[model samples]
Target: MSQPADYRDPRSLRSRERIIRALRAELRAGRSLTIAAVTGEAKVTRQTFYNNFDSLEEAGWFALLEDFNTLLVDDIQTRWSGASPDFVGLASLRKIVELLRAESSLSLLANGYRDEAGLTGLAAVMLSEIRRFRAEFGDPASPLAQEEDLYTATGLCGLLTVAATGDASSTSIARAAYALLPEWMRQPRL
Candidate 1:
């Protein structure tokens, strides 16, 4: 016998959601996430937090990813659904940059990861999802060769890191990303 899709106990989901929300709030407030911090924020015990996540980074990354998924639903997935790949890719990238403008917390997540653990496993997973989203939703006029895709993804993440560390306003960050990201995206075409 097989279980149906979307099958999880309500209690478990509520507990996890509380933990994620707590972690997210902490990081957004410019506080680095710690086991103690998250447990206190979530009103959960050390054992409960540990049972849900192996480490603080894992929880942080998961919370960030969940937020990304929501952003995708709000801006990219719904609006750009069924649009051409090129259109989707460019639009999504622009939206992503715009999101950085709108949400300071996202910047916290991006730059925070750089120091918490350089090139973390959670980061790789998030990158993979980003690259996949662009590939699937925003295909270029011409197909990108393997290396080109890698470069584009790397450049985008690197730009995010730079933006995250800067003391500029979200508007300034958005402007710089708008100017630079297009050039980087164009590289694969050249």
Candidate 2:
């Protein structure tokens, strides 16, 4: 399974870490990401950055996804206990917002460069984890269940990108996301 970007050698790992840190700093400063700019900021050779990542966006997205896998996915899996779908969906959305807040650079990269940074790839990672969650904690997912999961995963990526870039508060974004949850997952009114 693809966890984080792991390296066998300490030197390579250190180089990659420096590159990611530099990417984050560039993003925080609202600088355009380019190989030359990143390498200069990282104080690494262009070849060193290339050895670690194909592009500046790739490095940013990879770091973001790694954190998502470690922080959100693991936490969700740990919390699963056949809870109602509404509970799971809302909790997951809230956690995503919290994750983005904690990692401002990742949020900026994801939001500012949504298409370039490959948010769809992030959604795919989320889908796989959602599939795993269903397999372990609930009944075998039906076609409808799978569809719901796909929508939830993709929708969140788009919604989160908007939340990061727009004026919407995180709580407001969460509320809107909750309201838009798949009907099947929503609780019935009293």
Best by lDDT: 2
Question: Which stretches of candidate 1 lie above 4 Å from their native place?
Answer: 1-7, 28-33, 78-95, 98-118, 121-126, 138-149, 167-190
Displacement of residue 180 (Cα, Å) in model 2 is 5.3
lDDT of each: 0.56, 0.66
lDDT per residue for candidate 1 within 1-190, as digits (tens), equals 1121332867556767888888778867878767788789989888777666666656665666666666556544544445543454455555555555555564455444442325443344345554555564445444653445455446666675566546665455545544544333433221
Candidate 1: the clashing residue pairs are 85-139, 89-138
TM-score of each candidate structure, all chains considered together: 0.60, 0.63
Candidate 2 residue lDDT tens string, 1-190: 1222556778888888888788778877877778788889989998888788765556776777666667556545535545565665676667777777667666555433334324455565556555665565544446577777878878866777668556667777777777866554344221
Residue 22 shift from truth in candidate 2, angstroms: 1.2
